[model samples]
Target: MNQGDKWTYFLGCYPLYSHDADDNRMFRIITSQLIDAGLCRQIEILNTFGVSKSSVARSLRKYRADGIEAFFQPRKTRKGGRVLTEDVLTKAQTLLDQGFTSGNVADELHVKRDTLRKAINDGRLSTKALPPEYTTKSCRTTIDAEAAKNMGTACTRPEERIVAAFGVCDGAPVRFEPCIDIPKGGVLCALPVLLMNGLLNGAERFFGTLSGYYRTFHIIILVAFMALCRIKTVEQLRGHAPGEFGKLLGLDRIPEVRCLRSKLRELGSDADIIKQWSAYLSKYWMDQDPQAAGTLYVDGHVRVYHGGLTKLPRKFVSRQRLCLRGTNDFWVNDATGRPFFVVDKTVNPGMLAVLEQDIVPRLLKDVPNQAYDKDLIADPFLSRFVMVFDREGYSPQFFKKMWKEHRISCITYHKFPDDAWPEEWFKEQKVTMPSGEVVTMQLAEMGSFIGHKKSGLWVREVRKLTNSRHQTSLVSTAYDMEYQKLASCMFSRWCQENFFGYMMHHFAIDLLAEYGTEQLPAGEEVVNPAWRQLVRERSSLQNKHRYRKVKFAELTLSEPDANDENAYNVWFSLKSSLLEELEHYEHELEGVKERIKSTPKHIAWEELSEEDQFQRLSPGRKQLMDTIRMIAYRAETAMAGLMKGPTIDTPAARRILQDLFITEADILPDTNAKILTVRVHKASRPAVNRALSLLFKRLNNSEVIYPGTDMQIFYELGGEGHPQNAGKGVTQTSPK
Candidate 1:
């Protein structure tokens, strides 16, 4: 179509190209843009207008290579066409430094305002006056607008990002700024306890650094603090004010949920790091208190998986009394139930195998002050250490092997025992429990031979006679151990179980920190699907056979009324059919048994067919989170020990400590003296205040320094002038 000297091209009445008819460059650019955007195909233009293929390709190539600007550039331009020359750049910087706004500087220097701004942002030019220092003012924001009052920086640390990009800094240093009435300042009370528990130990060596404001140390401390404060998951950070949590970390604000999740994934990338760190802490903790490690209580807690990621192997959850899809964590704890370390198993090989392969081996290395070999030889009854578990770990052969091979004595409930000894054998005696409570008990001891004759283990069989006339039997390889101590240790296995219960309720230990699955180790052995199927089928057949046999026996034992021939006939027929069915079931059961025997019970992971193979829930992040929770629990336990007086029980003491952790406190940072005084506010009750005062006083004596800072932490009970809500204690949220 033509109108005056202008012309337009139309496709199906829609204008495709419109420009002055002589403007071929404009036409080329528009058509190439349409083709690049997939709005119009090149073939359409080539066929519709009979344009040469080379001409269209050339235009499209320009659009692809140099963008639309290529269409406007002079084809043969000289190099001197640049407007921002060295002299102009120098003048621009001079104007910027002379208090000239970026727009004014750009106008004066005949440069684009964006160009001037970019130069300033890139550090090529400096503003006339520096901005005020950043003071944290807001909460729960992606960008901290309070940062240095420079809105142009997008509130994000642009300079730090640049430096990190250039590998100049690994992470932001922990720099604390002074503030009053900081929320959750009481959580800082845990810093000393966490450090003493080796929360930050081996962190630098194992994790290296995280490339952001929240470094490795920051993330580790954040997680530990979260555990202590009962922040169940990373996602839960959204519910709390990030700025308030940041005060706990000595940061402007905590990392957002997504950012924290990414950090966790990065930290958990190497599963081996979690293992090594846990091992290191185990040794460190054991070294701190050798007697506690002498008798380690081992137990397995199943963490159920309710995700759709993969079909995890089902394990019988004793607590729930149902076989649930989950992973098993076998925790080895001290006599007081303070965890040393935990071993997780996806395809569990049972308690016996785990103790033999994983737990005992680590114990051999970490359990300090073990009796020397020469000492063991001089006294055959002497043991390196004692392993106390429940009846689940009981095995005559295992007990024998532990004593014979490693001399690591084992104490567990006797899985099998002869009839209880005569009542006369029991004697009343006072047994000092691990908790230092003295209780009277009727106890007796004897030497019992267990396992096969040649390889049998001579174990001390200890029995506790209760008032109800029930005898609780216990077996121990620690032959020389006092019978009362054996009974005490045997009963102390409940501490590990209690640990599981308390952690599940208070610490959310069962919560999955991350969701995803990883391939199980190559060549790892798992239960054979085919064999399992055969065994299941065999059991079904056996059940049917037993039912039919019971019915047949009943028929044989019964006498049908002789007067009624039809009744007798019916009975005979029913009995015959039942017997025939039983015979058939027996045959099927035998066949299934044979199949089970032929099929390997366990097979390599790779040996499974593609459809049968499965991935395990990623344990790296969960294990890391579990270890953090363990540290939190141990810290609380240690503090509770300090708080538990004759008046307070363990539970009450722990409750008070939890309240103390969340109580508001004044964080006084003395930069000059390098001291961080955490003046915790007073509790509602004077008793609690006194207990907290004594607890903090004990903590103060430790001389522990805050992580990433040289400032020594000092604790005190705040005066009554502080408001009750100043540091509101965080209570563990009840599980939904």
Candidate 2:
């Protein structure tokens, strides 16, 4: 059959127009099977398939005799006088100029490669021009050999001066004696926890003294304390008096914003060391309290990029409901909503991919061993690492892999269920929140299983029905966990979201850590924008073709059949035109398909030329900020746990903590008794004053001395009347 006659066979489930040569050849194979199986009777096939009985018979006989090669294939027929369309020729030239090979251009324009070559040879089209974006150029960065050689071990301070300042430690360990001499302002409240947690504890002047008044420890402390005080950015220091904030670090004056950032760069240069320190603190936390890993919440927080230095791929910021240029940071927090750790996802990988590839593997190695104690958790099932996340980790295959391969159990929302649980399955239960509030809610579990295999070895899926006829499904491998408890763990993924929200609102978590682009590694894989555009164009054309085909069919089916004569010719004329247009779109779609087949989904960053090659952002400052913010939050959270009930209202505790951090208190140092007393004067609110009194007693009970002075910490309310210090008059008090 000719190409025109063969299109009449574009009927049945496998439409001929919708497939390529390979697929049509498979279609013929399938047809042979059906005819042999007695499912394809010639009369019925002809009636439904629009193909004549004679052609159908011929195709079946030829297919059986020749074993699948006898089916009619589309042939490349040259129209004797048909000239290339202006649009197609223009497109072909444009692609050729963009460095596309002649064969590629020919395929894109639906012309024979030989035809394109002849056109180029005859000077009808030029394949010599090159688009600027695709042209490669050498990037030269100057290197001062002497300076580059000496850069690593260059110490600004003389060795003699360091030995003089910090007495020469000839095998004597350099240690920071717990100084009860902590400033009693906003910093005193959390310094003990911060110090004990070992955030800036191990940081020392290993390479010798820096130029700033603050040592490395002091610089790190200043950064953390700034975040604790809700001074989210360095620029915010402009609003604060330096002397006032400096007192928090026991310094006469705080370092300038530039100096602090410089120190951060100096200290943060050893990223591996800092990360090890951070990991030490996390492991220590879990070691002290294994319940912290009772259920770990994992999710991604997209920090939108507002700068224009380099364009990041657009990520959907769920908060704003708008996709914007940003970086994705996957955070893993414990059941208490305190962050375990956060990973900066530089390449914009999806939440699930990052979880399995980076987050989970790390957790499996670091946690589980240190997080669970034999005596702490009575439920053997609870001892298994239970990771809670949202629907991003919802693949049944992933869940199965997590359980079988790594022995890591997870809780996440189930996304692919068709029907909601019946109303009778749901019942109200009083669930205790992490904040200790008893909440009454309707929750249900059918113990429904998931997995393609039907041996019933699958995750238990639970659902929570709402008044609006909505159902929220949670699937977990924690089969031994109580249904209510499982439901709670899954729903608590919001705590991580809340953590992101809180950090963004109060700590400027969304702020750019630093606006600097770094050199991307050569040949790093990146999405091919040109290939993506081609896919988009192909999809658009396919959609248009489908739409026009439907329109053509509708016109032909609805045509007036007033008689089988000249009266209905107008509608017939319209149908015939639409069909011709539909055929043109189909042909163009085939050309697009051919083009898409050869384009790679991702190309090396170096392939895009120098300007596009260096788009990856630096993570140094962001990592610094994330570390400090987590420590500050952890300390704040610990203090909040103590002030839960009558001492401080649980709900308003975060605000109260902020107030305490910003409050002006009198620093009373009783070095004679080895006790430092902080006399907090009258607060703006009496409740705050009362709450601080209780918190002070609680901190004193811990007997945590300050970092450098030998005195037990003490907190006292003003003896009688006191004036508002306005962040002044908070000098360290001496012992009588």
Candidate 3:
């Protein structure tokens, strides 16, 4: 209601207060009180009364600070003045005379550049140009160098940290500039293969772009190069020239270790996203080579943790022959040992559990060219795909279940085999291995029942008799496959093992990517410490009981000659004592067994007592790094495949690739033509140089574009008598 220019406000028809419109101070005080009393909301006041939000906020802040009297307090006025005080001007003039720029002087004196320039223009200050030796250009950053080279002004293009500081640019596109003798320039040769293997596939979608100088693409390529160059850890980056390495990335320099780690932390904030990226890449790889996907090799590699931050569960590290605290990574690789994906388990449930629960489901979905439903029904022996692993996955029940439920086959070393077959049963047969090597082997096959007689499953058991007359037995549910192929496939499981060893030695696969630990999820189940202790106790008692029983039985108690009654009495006493101890241990073992049966084998993480609890190593960053390394390994493998010939075998080809990665080369960037020419220098050996030149030709044929750039990569050999110019009076071979 309004009366004589005064307005009254009401809530639910109850009068709140009345005041004239011109009485701004009273209005502010009452409005603040209404909001403070919860009679109205700030938004409601602004919306219903068409008042500015700042006005309402200011009124509330003033009232809250000084109560209602604050609205009537005197209004404050600004006290503005020239910031260039006499003392500040004196210091600025001195800095100007000492070769500092006007902008620098303004920054040093905390004054505006325009104000400083005005002072100079008024003749109040004088400036001097520094000698060429003292100029800032003498110390050029990567950004400044790129700018001088006409490669644009953005620092680490597509993502400029400098401009991004002011929120003007989101990312700077990747650009290249010409350079001479860039160290490790040969790493660019693998870029095509890395891209082919989907190194950056789904990266932007999953990780988004990092907000600073290093974009997702740069970090990934840098990491891949580091892996290829044998730079195992981020800390190793400090030992190398950042500017030199930055050339490989087409940047001024790779980010500092701390900057890289922050970028990694931001990219790996979510573990699920990393897994999704890995899965996407895995599908791409499988889809690219469906033949390799037909048979997958599954195995577990333990990454031991020596850190004292958290107490991880102990796993038997077969390589070290000792139980160690670590996590297990179950890798699914193709027959040739190229990785498809990996599943990490901090609380390992064993190979069988992982295959059935984590691995098989993924294989069933990802394994391409599964037999049609009608085709599967038409042929009883038909199977969708085969899984090969070590003996740890040998389970007759699992084999039967996979065949019956999923129509999937399994090949693994038999956990238990009968005595060797007759010598004449084995015949020498030539087998073609996955590596295209044919070898003669004494092989034989027979149908055998595994497990109990009544519930056992019939499987094809193939055995190979070595030159030493030792039989290597293998079990397979693939009934229709020939014994020769089964033998080759089973033996090829070593490819995966070799993959692990090579990665551990060269790629540092077992190293911890990060040292952070996180608490395990509440419902995550781990082995129960109490149950494990009870089992250990029972085992100790059983061993003691067995020893005592042996002692008691060995006491023959032969009747001593009638003349040696003392000897007979001593023997009887010892035998009686042994029997008594055996009986005691037997009783104790029974009690312990009963307790073990009563205790739960696995308990949730939250159920454990404080002292028994532990956090698991952070998997997010490790998983990301592992994926990049996997890509790097695959790329190297692909290049090695191209380099293999009569002179260069797989091992030699890989060695050449490693050397090529660290070899110096000249980089010629043709911006107009959009081509990046990496001229690799010749190797010490003429044979290796010829092989590298051939490899480069093959890579150029693919015409793979550099990631994050439009430039097509062109690789060639440098130095005299290069293979490309061999016809021009240049010998292909160089003498020592």
Candidate 4:
């Protein structure tokens, strides 16, 4: 055959059935030659002709059971028995004894390693015995049992007490100290510890001296309030301790609220007192534990509302608007969120400069005896740890002064550009950023910026899209390697947001809302000390007045009524009205269902007579169909428990229904709008129908109705300035 024909003959045809007789004859000749060469047997040749080599071996075993004639005769098939040779067993035992390599032995014996190894494993061969002294039993039940019993005895109560009283000293003596006092217990001890360490000084001074006036309840409430408001003010103090003038002053009777307000006013402007308290609390906190390190987070927030109308010279304007800013510079335990030595101050160039200068010195002085390992963290506005301005905050003059001060250790984020990164650093790494985009970058190939005086600031430049089309590059000095993996900075920014969130949400002292108002004069404008003093004095007085006006009893005590006849009568009337309204709604719902079921069914156009099919639908028929569908849907919904009738009489249900359905038109001016709106809607058929559907859905679902009143709901639904559809929108006037 030709090459193509040969190719088809080999691959496409069966050796025994192909028309290519020469190819089939060649195959038989090759098989017979292989059998004659002892590569295979005669039975193998027959079996190969019949099936395969493996089958040939199996057929030979069957032939031995029923003679050579069995090849032609049919016999029941049985599993072949193992053909274990003496050589295999001998090799297995030899390998197990000498730790002979399994692969090497299998190659030498011309057998599978697993098969030989399994023979040894199956206990067909014995591993040579080792010396008695060296061979240890794998399992020793007696020793284990003895050890468990001893452990049980050691764990007994008497043994525990002895162990507690006398601690083991090495493998010899025992040391005992049974009378050691437990560390001071509870908040009482904690407060003193905090005070000694200077953690409570700022709070103590701001809230007044804790020596004779601090009551446990007052302190607890005050702390709770401070935690809530974030910033302590005279106004908040009065609000939380209303009516109990004595409680405010730690006395038994009600003191004049004015007196309490006066005291806070006196204490309010005393920055020195707060400073002293902050120092004391810081000291107290530092002394309590030797192993704990103190790290303080210092940050500033601008209370923009406070400086609203404040007049200032052009020089005093730092980046624009009037502002009463406060530095929430505080010390906190690194391991815990406990705050201490807080100082809230008005921000000005001089004040800011002084506060910045004093923070480190005060912290160091407070923790004088302890090792000074603490670190300070803040934004670029704060000076570096070594007292140098951060490169981001650097100016030529600032750096010159910082160099003179020799506090370069504090300059953590600064670096020079001449330094070449290592080749390994150039390995590419991928990061998924806050915007859910994958960014590929190499650590070694990052860029740097030059700050005020050629000071190098290492920053990563990232390209971000602004307003969709505008791509802008941002440089960031604060690098969070782990945040790169997340889809958003939300989780990473949580701690930072929480600090502000606490001040806004919990403390009610949203700096943005409460401060920097026009009412407070700006710093430079009040450069004249006497005028500034007058402004401060007046501000304090105004604050005290505001504080008094906010006073309302935080807790009230009421006597129980001896006669509840009026209450009982009111409740009975309410219950009766609710039942009557519920019954009426049920009856109306049944009528709607009956009306829907009585409607005529539609006839198919093709099945109808040609004249009837061509006729246009009458307005009356269309209305009937619409009415039928609406009623049927309402009935089915009601039966499915997806809608419910409103209960009457009960103010809550009436409130809900009226809020859900009635519109502004249904609300009459000067009337009891809550009740009158409901009455007006009841008189309007369309309003009533709409109300039944809307209120039933709302009430059945127990959903909260926002703006919870008919007038509000109507106005929200585009009722304002539009009268064409005001009272006739999407609602039927006639009930079924």
Q: Which number leads on lDDT? A: 3
Better of 2 and 4 by lDDT: 2
Ranking by lDDT: 3, 1, 2, 4
Better of 2 and 3 by lDDT: 3
lDDT (tens digit, per residue) of candidate 1 on 280-341: 88899999999998998889889998888888899999888999999888898887889989
Q: Comparing candidate 1 with candidate 4, which one achieves the higher TM-score?
A: 1
What root-mean-square deviation over C-alphas does model 3 reach? 26.0
What's each prediction's TM-score?
0.77, 0.69, 0.77, 0.29
Candidate 3 regions exceeding 4 Å error are 1-161, 557-559, 720-736
Candidate 3 pairs with clashing backbones: 157-172, 158-171, 158-172, 158-173, 159-172
Lowest summed lDDT window (length 10), candidate 4: 178-187
The TM-score measured for candidate 2 stands at: 0.69
Candidate 1: pairs in clash: 664-727
Over the stretch 194-242, how does candidate 4's per-residue lDDT look in tens digits? 1222222244334443222222224333332233222234344444322
Every candidate's lDDT: 0.80, 0.66, 0.83, 0.33
Give the alpha carbon lDDT tens digit for every residue of 87-180 in model 3: 7778987787654578767877788888888777776788884344321222435554565455343233433656765667654456566666
Clash count, predicted structure 1: 1
> Which ten-residue region of model 3 has the weakest summed lDDT?
727-736
lDDT of 2 by residue, 586-692 (tens): 88888878887888878877787565544767777677677878888888888887777765565478778887777666554433455555555556777777776
Please give the lDDT score for candidate 1: 0.80
